[model samples]
Target: MSSREAINVISILGSDYSIKAPVGEEQTLLNATRMLNATLADTKRKYPTLIGDKLLVLAALNLCSQQLEMKQRHQEELDRYQEQVNATVDVISRTIGKN
Candidate 1:
Protein backbone atom coordinates (compact mmCIF):
# COMPACT_ATOMS: atom_id res chain seq x y z
CA MET A 1 0.00 0.00 0.00
CA SER A 2 1.12 3.55 -0.61
CA SER A 3 2.31 5.52 2.42
CA ARG A 4 -0.58 7.97 2.24
CA GLU A 5 -3.13 5.22 1.72
CA ALA A 6 -1.82 3.27 4.71
CA ILE A 7 -2.29 6.13 7.16
CA ASN A 8 -5.61 6.26 8.98
CA VAL A 9 -7.04 8.34 11.80
CA ILE A 10 -8.47 6.31 14.70
CA SER A 11 -10.60 7.73 17.48
CA ILE A 12 -10.13 6.29 20.95
CA LEU A 13 -11.66 7.71 24.14
CA GLY A 14 -12.53 10.91 22.23
CA SER A 15 -8.95 11.35 21.09
CA ASP A 16 -7.73 11.17 17.53
CA TYR A 17 -4.76 8.89 16.92
CA SER A 18 -3.04 8.78 13.54
CA ILE A 19 -1.81 5.26 12.91
CA LYS A 20 0.08 3.78 9.97
CA ALA A 21 -1.37 0.44 9.03
CA PRO A 22 -2.10 -1.49 5.85
CA VAL A 23 -5.28 -0.42 4.04
CA GLY A 24 -7.05 -3.69 4.74
CA GLU A 25 -5.99 -3.62 8.41
CA GLU A 26 -7.87 -0.42 9.24
CA GLN A 27 -10.71 -2.44 10.76
CA THR A 28 -8.32 -4.43 12.91
CA LEU A 29 -6.61 -1.27 14.16
CA LEU A 30 -9.93 0.41 14.84
CA ASN A 31 -11.17 -2.62 16.74
CA ALA A 32 -8.02 -2.78 18.87
CA THR A 33 -8.24 0.95 19.59
CA ARG A 34 -11.89 0.56 20.59
CA MET A 35 -11.00 -2.30 22.90
CA LEU A 36 -8.26 -0.20 24.50
CA ASN A 37 -10.64 2.69 25.01
CA ALA A 38 -13.20 0.36 26.59
CA THR A 39 -10.55 -1.09 28.86
CA LEU A 40 -9.46 2.37 29.97
CA ALA A 41 -13.02 3.47 30.54
CA ASP A 42 -13.79 0.40 32.59
CA THR A 43 -10.68 0.89 34.70
CA LYS A 44 -11.50 4.56 35.31
CA ARG A 45 -15.05 3.71 36.24
CA LYS A 46 -14.06 0.90 38.60
CA TYR A 47 -11.24 2.91 40.18
CA PRO A 48 -11.87 6.62 40.14
CA THR A 49 -8.19 7.37 40.81
CA LEU A 50 -6.92 5.67 37.66
CA ILE A 51 -5.43 8.04 35.06
CA GLY A 52 -5.16 7.66 31.29
CA ASP A 53 -1.42 7.01 31.08
CA LYS A 54 -1.55 4.54 33.94
CA LEU A 55 -4.36 2.63 32.25
CA LEU A 56 -2.40 2.58 29.01
CA VAL A 57 0.66 1.30 30.85
CA LEU A 58 -1.39 -1.46 32.43
CA ALA A 59 -2.70 -2.45 29.03
CA ALA A 60 0.83 -2.52 27.62
CA LEU A 61 1.96 -4.69 30.49
CA ASN A 62 -0.89 -7.10 29.88
CA LEU A 63 0.09 -7.35 26.20
CA CYS A 64 3.74 -7.89 27.12
CA SER A 65 2.75 -10.61 29.57
CA GLN A 66 0.84 -12.44 26.86
CA GLN A 67 3.81 -12.23 24.49
CA LEU A 68 6.22 -13.55 27.12
CA GLU A 69 3.93 -16.46 27.94
CA MET A 70 3.74 -17.42 24.27
CA LYS A 71 7.50 -17.16 23.89
CA GLN A 72 8.09 -19.35 26.94
CA ARG A 73 5.70 -21.99 25.68
CA HIS A 74 7.41 -22.01 22.26
CA GLN A 75 10.84 -22.30 23.88
CA GLU A 76 9.69 -25.29 25.93
CA GLU A 77 8.48 -27.02 22.79
CA LEU A 78 11.80 -26.33 21.01
CA ASP A 79 13.74 -27.73 23.95
CA ARG A 80 11.68 -30.88 23.93
CA TYR A 81 12.26 -31.38 20.22
CA GLN A 82 16.00 -30.86 20.62
CA GLU A 83 16.13 -33.41 23.42
CA GLN A 84 14.33 -35.96 21.25
CA VAL A 85 16.77 -35.35 18.41
CA ASN A 86 19.74 -35.77 20.73
CA ALA A 87 18.33 -39.01 22.05
CA THR A 88 17.88 -40.38 18.52
CA VAL A 89 21.40 -39.36 17.52
CA ASP A 90 22.86 -41.04 20.58
CA VAL A 91 20.99 -44.25 19.79
CA ILE A 92 22.25 -44.23 16.20
CA SER A 93 25.84 -43.56 17.27
CA ARG A 94 25.73 -46.47 19.71
CA THR A 95 24.29 -48.88 17.08
CA ILE A 96 26.93 -47.87 14.49
CA GLY A 97 29.70 -48.24 17.04
CA LYS A 98 28.53 -51.75 17.90
CA ASN A 99 28.37 -52.78 14.21
Candidate 2:
Protein backbone atom coordinates (compact mmCIF):
# COMPACT_ATOMS: atom_id res chain seq x y z
CA MET A 1 0.00 0.00 0.00
CA SER A 2 1.16 3.53 -0.78
CA SER A 3 1.96 5.94 2.03
CA ARG A 4 -1.05 8.01 1.09
CA GLU A 5 -3.27 4.97 1.54
CA ALA A 6 -2.31 4.59 5.17
CA ILE A 7 -4.96 3.24 7.51
CA ASN A 8 -6.31 5.40 10.28
CA VAL A 9 -7.14 4.07 13.72
CA ILE A 10 -10.48 5.03 15.16
CA SER A 11 -12.47 4.07 18.21
CA ILE A 12 -15.94 2.67 17.66
CA LEU A 13 -18.24 1.08 20.21
CA GLY A 14 -15.30 1.10 22.64
CA SER A 15 -13.27 -0.94 20.16
CA ASP A 16 -10.34 0.08 17.99
CA TYR A 17 -10.96 -0.06 14.27
CA SER A 18 -8.34 0.61 11.64
CA ILE A 19 -9.68 1.59 8.24
CA LYS A 20 -7.76 2.53 5.12
CA ALA A 21 -9.32 5.33 3.10
CA PRO A 22 -8.62 8.55 1.24
CA VAL A 23 -7.01 11.52 2.99
CA GLY A 24 -10.26 13.35 3.66
CA GLU A 25 -12.18 10.23 4.72
CA GLU A 26 -11.53 10.85 8.41
CA GLN A 27 -14.81 12.68 8.93
CA THR A 28 -16.74 10.06 7.02
CA LEU A 29 -15.14 7.32 9.07
CA LEU A 30 -15.89 9.17 12.27
CA ASN A 31 -19.50 9.64 11.24
CA ALA A 32 -19.85 5.93 10.44
CA THR A 33 -18.26 4.96 13.74
CA ARG A 34 -20.59 7.25 15.61
CA MET A 35 -23.60 5.80 13.83
CA LEU A 36 -22.49 2.28 14.63
CA ASN A 37 -22.00 3.12 18.27
CA ALA A 38 -25.38 4.75 18.40
CA THR A 39 -27.04 1.74 16.81
CA LEU A 40 -25.31 -0.67 19.19
CA ALA A 41 -26.22 1.38 22.21
CA ASP A 42 -29.80 1.76 21.10
CA THR A 43 -30.13 -1.94 20.41
CA LYS A 44 -28.58 -2.91 23.71
CA ARG A 45 -30.94 -0.60 25.53
CA LYS A 46 -34.05 -1.84 23.72
CA TYR A 47 -33.03 -5.53 23.72
CA PRO A 48 -30.73 -6.45 26.53
CA THR A 49 -30.33 -10.01 25.28
CA LEU A 50 -29.06 -8.91 21.87
CA ILE A 51 -25.66 -10.48 21.15
CA GLY A 52 -23.29 -11.88 18.50
CA ASP A 53 -24.68 -11.80 14.92
CA LYS A 54 -28.01 -10.50 16.10
CA LEU A 55 -26.49 -7.19 17.19
CA LEU A 56 -24.76 -6.73 13.86
CA VAL A 57 -27.94 -7.55 11.99
CA LEU A 58 -29.97 -5.12 14.05
CA ALA A 59 -27.39 -2.35 13.50
CA ALA A 60 -27.34 -3.01 9.78
CA LEU A 61 -31.13 -2.82 9.63
CA ASN A 62 -31.17 0.42 11.56
CA LEU A 63 -28.57 1.99 9.30
CA CYS A 64 -30.34 0.74 6.19
CA SER A 65 -33.61 2.25 7.37
CA GLN A 66 -31.93 5.62 7.87
CA GLN A 67 -30.38 5.46 4.40
CA LEU A 68 -33.67 4.52 2.80
CA GLU A 69 -35.48 7.40 4.46
CA MET A 70 -32.88 9.88 3.26
CA LYS A 71 -32.95 8.43 -0.26
CA GLN A 72 -36.76 8.68 -0.41
CA ARG A 73 -36.68 12.31 0.69
CA HIS A 74 -34.01 13.10 -1.90
CA GLN A 75 -36.01 11.40 -4.65
CA GLU A 76 -39.08 13.40 -3.69
CA GLU A 77 -37.08 16.63 -4.02
CA LEU A 78 -35.75 15.56 -7.43
CA ASP A 79 -39.25 14.71 -8.63
CA ARG A 80 -40.50 18.15 -7.56
CA TYR A 81 -37.62 19.83 -9.38
CA GLN A 82 -38.31 17.82 -12.53
CA GLU A 83 -41.97 18.80 -12.42
CA GLN A 84 -41.04 22.47 -12.14
CA VAL A 85 -38.60 22.16 -15.00
CA ASN A 86 -41.18 20.48 -17.21
CA ALA A 87 -43.71 23.21 -16.49
CA THR A 88 -41.19 25.93 -17.39
CA VAL A 89 -40.21 24.10 -20.59
CA ASP A 90 -43.83 23.68 -21.61
CA VAL A 91 -44.50 27.41 -21.17
CA ILE A 92 -41.37 28.33 -23.15
CA SER A 93 -42.26 25.93 -25.97
CA ARG A 94 -45.75 27.39 -26.27
CA THR A 95 -44.43 30.95 -26.28
CA ILE A 96 -41.95 30.13 -29.08
CA GLY A 97 -44.54 28.34 -31.15
CA LYS A 98 -46.88 31.41 -30.96
CA ASN A 99 -44.13 33.79 -32.16
Candidate 3:
Protein backbone atom coordinates (compact mmCIF):
# COMPACT_ATOMS: atom_id res chain seq x y z
CA MET A 1 0.00 0.00 0.00
CA SER A 2 1.18 3.51 -0.79
CA SER A 3 1.20 6.41 1.60
CA ARG A 4 -1.22 8.12 -0.74
CA GLU A 5 -4.95 7.88 -0.16
CA ALA A 6 -6.65 4.96 -1.85
CA ILE A 7 -10.04 6.52 -2.29
CA ASN A 8 -11.62 7.32 -5.61
CA VAL A 9 -14.73 9.20 -6.69
CA ILE A 10 -16.80 7.76 -9.51
CA SER A 11 -20.19 8.26 -11.10
CA ILE A 12 -22.70 5.48 -10.93
CA LEU A 13 -26.30 5.63 -12.06
CA GLY A 14 -26.01 9.41 -12.16
CA SER A 15 -24.79 9.51 -8.59
CA ASP A 16 -21.29 10.32 -7.42
CA TYR A 17 -19.75 7.61 -5.23
CA SER A 18 -16.63 7.56 -3.11
CA ILE A 19 -14.95 4.19 -2.92
CA LYS A 20 -12.00 3.41 -0.66
CA ALA A 21 -9.82 0.46 -1.43
CA PRO A 22 -6.18 -0.59 -1.63
CA VAL A 23 -4.00 1.81 -3.56
CA GLY A 24 -3.91 -0.25 -6.74
CA GLU A 25 -7.56 -1.28 -6.52
CA GLU A 26 -9.16 1.99 -7.60
CA GLN A 27 -9.57 0.73 -11.16
CA THR A 28 -11.22 -2.46 -9.98
CA LEU A 29 -13.74 -0.46 -7.96
CA LEU A 30 -14.35 1.81 -10.90
CA ASN A 31 -14.93 -1.17 -13.16
CA ALA A 32 -17.39 -2.66 -10.69
CA THR A 33 -19.37 0.58 -10.59
CA ARG A 34 -19.35 0.73 -14.37
CA MET A 35 -20.81 -2.76 -14.54
CA LEU A 36 -23.45 -1.84 -12.00
CA ASN A 37 -24.39 1.30 -13.88
CA ALA A 38 -24.62 -0.69 -17.04
CA THR A 39 -26.95 -3.14 -15.37
CA LEU A 40 -29.13 -0.29 -14.09
CA ALA A 41 -29.17 1.35 -17.51
CA ASP A 42 -30.08 -1.89 -19.21
CA THR A 43 -32.80 -2.59 -16.68
CA LYS A 44 -34.17 0.93 -17.02
CA ARG A 45 -34.28 0.55 -20.78
CA LYS A 46 -36.05 -2.80 -20.63
CA TYR A 47 -38.58 -1.59 -18.08
CA PRO A 48 -38.95 2.11 -18.58
CA THR A 49 -42.20 2.05 -16.72
CA LEU A 50 -40.35 1.04 -13.57
CA ILE A 51 -38.93 3.98 -11.68
CA GLY A 52 -37.14 4.99 -8.50
CA ASP A 53 -37.22 2.24 -5.85
CA LYS A 54 -38.69 -0.35 -8.19
CA LEU A 55 -35.90 -0.05 -10.74
CA LEU A 56 -33.18 -0.17 -8.13
CA VAL A 57 -34.78 -3.14 -6.40
CA LEU A 58 -34.98 -5.10 -9.65
CA ALA A 59 -31.34 -4.42 -10.52
CA ALA A 60 -30.14 -5.30 -7.03
CA LEU A 61 -32.16 -8.50 -7.04
CA ASN A 62 -30.75 -9.55 -10.40
CA LEU A 63 -27.17 -9.06 -9.20
CA CYS A 64 -27.83 -10.80 -5.90
CA SER A 65 -29.41 -13.78 -7.64
CA GLN A 66 -26.39 -14.27 -9.86
CA GLN A 67 -24.04 -13.85 -6.89
CA LEU A 68 -25.92 -16.49 -4.88
CA GLU A 69 -25.73 -19.01 -7.72
CA MET A 70 -22.00 -18.48 -8.01
CA LYS A 71 -21.56 -18.88 -4.25
CA GLN A 72 -23.53 -22.14 -4.32
CA ARG A 73 -21.30 -23.50 -7.06
CA HIS A 74 -18.16 -22.48 -5.20
CA GLN A 75 -19.49 -24.06 -2.02
CA GLU A 76 -20.13 -27.31 -3.85
CA GLU A 77 -16.59 -27.34 -5.17
CA LEU A 78 -15.19 -26.59 -1.71
CA ASP A 79 -17.23 -29.40 -0.21
CA ARG A 80 -15.86 -31.84 -2.78
CA TYR A 81 -12.31 -30.68 -2.10
CA GLN A 82 -12.75 -31.00 1.67
CA GLU A 83 -14.15 -34.50 1.27
CA GLN A 84 -11.12 -35.55 -0.72
CA VAL A 85 -8.75 -34.06 1.84
CA ASN A 86 -10.57 -35.83 4.66
CA ALA A 87 -10.43 -39.14 2.85
CA THR A 88 -6.71 -38.79 2.25
CA VAL A 89 -6.09 -37.84 5.87
CA ASP A 90 -8.09 -40.82 7.11
CA VAL A 91 -6.13 -43.24 4.91
CA ILE A 92 -2.83 -41.82 6.07
CA SER A 93 -3.89 -41.90 9.72
CA ARG A 94 -4.95 -45.54 9.48
CA THR A 95 -1.76 -46.59 7.80
CA ILE A 96 0.33 -44.79 10.38
CA GLY A 97 -1.64 -46.22 13.31
CA LYS A 98 -1.15 -49.80 12.01
CA ASN A 99 2.66 -49.46 11.94
* Per-model tally of clashing residue pairs: 0, 0, 0
lDDT of 2 by residue, 40-62 (tens): 88988989898867887998898
Please give each candidate's TM-score.
Answer: 0.61, 0.84, 0.70
Which of candidates 1 and 2 is the stronger one according to lDDT? Answer: 2
lDDT of each: 0.80, 0.85, 0.86
Off by over 4 Å in 3: 1-7, 18-22, 97-99
Q: Which ten residues in a row have the lowest lDDT in candidate 1?
A: 55-64
Arranged by lDDT with the best first, the candidates are 3, 2, 1
Query: Which has the higher lDDT value, candidate number 1 or candidate number 3?
Result: 3
lDDT per residue (tens digit) for residues 1-99 in model 1: 576457778876567878898768888988888777776776667667766678678766766677899999999999999999999999999999999
lDDT of 2 at 41: 85
> In model 3, which range of ten residues has the least summed lDDT?
1-10
